[model samples]
Target chain A: MTAGIGAAIVILALPAATAALLSVLPSYRLSAAINVASAFVTLLAAVSLLAAAPQPNAYILVDDLNVVFIVLNTFVGFTASVFSATYIAHEIESGRLTPTHLRFYHAMYQFLLLSMNLALIANNIGLMWVAIELATLTTVLMVGLYRTQEAIEAAWKYFILGSVGIALALFGTILVYMAARPVVGEGVQGMLWTSLIAHVPAFDPALLNLAFVFLLLGYGTKVGLAPLHAWLPDAHAEGPTPISAVLSGLLLNVALYAVLRFKLLLDANAFALAPGPLMATLGLISVVFAAFMLYRRRDVKRMFAYSSIEHMGVIVFAFGIGGPLANFAALLHMAMHSLTKSAIFYTVGQVAQVKGTQQIADIRGLTVTHPLLGWSLVFGVFAIVGLPPMGVFMSEFLIVSSTYERAPWLALLLGFGLLVALGALVLRLQGMAFGAPIGSRAPAKASALPIVAHFALVLIAGVYLPPPIVTWFQHVAQLLR
Target chain B: MKGLDFDVAHLLAGGLVLISFMLLYQNRLYALLNVFALQAVVLSLSVAWQAYVQDANHLYVTAAIAFAFKAVIIPLALHRIIAELGIQRDVENVVGVGPTMLAGLALVALSEVVMLRIASEADVLAQEDLAFALSVVLLGMLMMVVRRNAVSMVVGFMSLENGLILAAAGAKGMPLVVEISVAFSVLVALVVIGVFLFRISERFETVDAHALDRFRGDQR
Candidate 1:
């Protein structure tokens, strides 16, 4: 199983690496087919990866820590590819994306899958940084594909800030190496997570302490933490919906994965302050900041971009208040969020296509317009806003409960932030999906399969988390602490 | 030879911080790109220095990549972009150079204090690298904040990346895994910038960003 999963990652990624040639050879349609097929295969591969070895290991073994995330990433990537299959067709029809650029786009899309997968499977800190940068760069191109003025500015902003984040992360990776070099010696082995972590105690406490700060700021920015989240909404609102969904649901988790891995290193040192308070503080700030901004979103994509920030804040905060219960909750939130948010984007993209606008005021009363898309949007919002029986509610409850245990005062702030966010999301959604039909109500013909697939996952997760999944998360939560 | 090694690292790292200041001082788009280019050159030197210090030859590739892609290619590309877009005229400064430098100085001091406090028990090299890194990061942010021109703002961001590379290379034998990734990221960045230049030209007639204020959430 482990071997199959490993091979699957290669299979999903190999086509992208080869598509550079195919793109140049003028076989655009074939390139797109290969790209989408491989992304789907990659999703299956990730599932198999989880099935094969759901235990942490010295190099590239799936565990509860990453099983949910890996699966979510591959699934989102697969669905986005499907959406892109249709979305790109429209772009081509409109002459927005030249077939030339479309070829490049598919190649980059596969490369992105490769990068995210590499990051998730990596057992070395440096490899993880490299993987993440690859993913960031791929999205930068895909986002700018429209080459419109706003698209250009958005893509440029994303590249600049994304580079800065990558730089910080690289430095943080180096610092982790510095912290480990003395104890582990100077070689490839020194950079491996299993090796560095095993010898973390003898490493310099001072280096570990400082390194953690850089790591948090660097990776946190990618995760869209406040004060550093300026690049996020712009990137999301401007990029193709597939890119937006992948960025929020998949790439963010990959960045957080880097932080958590380093957190494990710091935990091993026994000198780094629990790192909980700092994470909690940042998480709280992001939650509050994003919540307030959600009310101000004029663009549909931007509103959900802020939502990504808010949910990420909650997840990071849960980890900050780390315990088995909270950690487990954080992991669960991570999974549900990817499913629900991507499902939301699928609906948003389809709506925008049908209406010829993304302006919230223009897109009124989705239910009145198209029941299938409208109802999906409604259910997605309900799931996202933490309505009862949704998995988000379950995870958030645990986060608040854990916060209550640590600093009841912080819990009040967290609760306040969640409520504000809840109000904002539901309020806008109320108008956009349910009010009197506004503007155009014509529905675009597109595949409904991926949207349905994601919603089903969210529903199943909400209703019944498999016993094995629960057991996996519980053990992994303990391991994280 | 070893005697010159760490000193060279220190010099290259210090050069990065100095170039960061130069970034703050620039009021013209051409100057910003040139300074950014210089900064990238220094960054590669620092990376090469680490390769020497740690006997990690893989870092040599990182150094070469930084030199070729960041210092040479990106600067040339941005210069062409600005000139072609008719934005080669002096950039309109929202913040004067004097106060910006002062703010940069304050950021540098804050970084030194923080790095010193946190890494008191760390190796002297790391202590120095962390302080230098924070300053570069802050200056990059300052560039993003103070500059209204899209191109220079990107230059600031690249300078920030240079600082990170310097800091990363200074760590000595960190790993080769991210080395290739960093190269690929630079390539991706260039592609995006290329896409943006052509697209923005078509819409705004010029690439100045102040015009973008019109698109804010609350229309005036």
Candidate 2:
């Protein structure tokens, strides 16, 4: 228990310390290195936490559920930092970003990591809301880092939508506290997750139902579910590519984590409305909507942003199904999507730099011009689209097959969405990976280490059944009930 | 739970909802800002009254934040921004005043129905407060949708936040940690929106959201 607390403290403290240090450090290279180093140390702490016993308190909780998230969050945080180090250097060379912008960028990156870690670890629902709000604010600032007409516009749109969503979330949280007040008796005890979960069955069902609606719509906006995802593509396309990667990879998952926590709260109440159907319906809408939308994205980043919505849709649907196999599959799919999607963004970042345009019409024939980057992208696209022998395929297969056993009709609807999305991804992949080399053939200077490392891990996960990891996910799946 | 305490809280919260309707009815940015500031002031009073009734001293800090930042500082800064930018013109409306007011009235009814039905077991004070807070929040959203001006949208967002703070303060024995964080988030949100308004005006020469649509990446 003591070790777990120590590791958790280090996980949070490293980022806080680095954010302060990077703000004043004028040297771009040094700040970037420190950013990467801090993330690496945080990841190490998160890994050590996996072995610790569950610790629950008023403010912090370290358990199987959040341990999984913290590990993934920090792993992606570390790799994204490495990718950003090289990616930002190119932006500086091309004069798109100034040194001062890079300084702010590095500091905000650490702050984003800090806030997300805090959000995941917070046992108090109110503290979680505040941390999530801080994460949103930092990302809003970073999204506008370029300060282009579009960047500013995207940031503004994201800020308004994200803030309103968060406000509603806070209202829901307050409602939750109100629901608990009578049962738990008021004070800080009513706001603690450990206390609430233990007492939820005795709370008012109507209040729990109402709170779920608000929490779903509120955090669903951040999850980029359909109807609330307006700011997502714009934010992704206009921001720096590294920020795009983290936004897609980590932030979306963190928001989904928040939603799942509340879903658990609702599930614990015997008379409360089942949260599954609502989540399933929304997840299905996001999947089908994003699938069709993906076909028309003229920009590469925006297309992948749509892809993220689709994957999140699938994961949410799996969780909505809410059985052991489905929960495990959801967990597996989330991890795979984080690795594969960020790898795609990492490749896309370099590809955009080399071609000098994000417009699909301008860049073509990646295989002919840049084979190393091109092939890595091909692998990433295939992985993301859920081709066989990749981890995503394994998880998607489990989700579909399990859904088929439970509700074949819903499975069919899900299958159709997945197929539509698959078609769109394959079509885009064909255009970019083959055919006449269309744009400028500048030499790519970005490192391939992050992409290679992610793909290797994903490939191993797909083909092998690492017993300990399987046990870990199964334990988490059992707890989800 | 006493008569006087509940009545005061109800009156202030209902006044907030009324000002939210006024916010939606405005066809000019200055009028809208003034109405929003009015809502913020009413919100602070509502929060302060809740503090006194609940005997929770921490809520006074939340009330002070709303009064100082939302009511006074933000509106004055926005007023100066408008003067400097020379954009003190009539705000563009997506829907006419009659229709907007009608929609706002409908939203209030909907919120009251929802909150009152669901929270039947809770105390009368909290039940009425939740209903009024939801109305204010929904009306603030309506205001955001009804106006196309960037500055008005910011005002709409902050007013929506005022509704949230009211809800937080109304919940008895809620800790100070959440209240302070709520206040902090509001400040950060205003600063971010303030920065963006300047950047938007500088780049496009207008604060109209329509100016941004031309740059959408997905549009062909």
Docking class of 1: acceptable
Query: By TM-score, how accurate is candidate 1?
Result: 0.90
User: What TM-score do all the candidates reach, one by one?
Assistant: 0.90, 0.97
- Candidate DockQ values, in order, are 0.47, 0.61
Q: What does TM-score give for chain A of every model?
A: 0.95, 0.99
In model 1, residue pairs whose N, Cα or C atoms come closer than 3 Å (at least 3 residues apart or on different chains), thus clashing, are none
Q: What pairs collide in candidate 2?
A: none
Residue A168, candidate 2: C-alpha displacement in angstroms: 1.1
Query: For residues A249-298, could you state the per-residue lDDT of candidate 2 as single tens digits?
Result: 99999999999999999888889999999998899899999999999888
Candidate 1 residue B104 C-alpha distance from true site, Å: 2.9
Top model number, lDDT: 2
Candidate 2 local lDDT, B1-220, one digit each (tens): 6888878898999899888877887777788788878888898898889888988888888888788887888888888777777764688787889988999899999999999999998888888889998998898899888777777777777777777788778888887544554556565555535554654443233566555444666444
Q: After superposition, which runs of candidate 1 have C-alpha atoms over 4 Å from their true positions?
A: A1-12, A15-32, A54-61, B1-12, B28-56, B59-63, B66-75, B116-140, B177-196, B199-220
Provide the lDDT at A148 for model 1: 72
State the lDDT at A46 in candidate 1.
Answer: 73
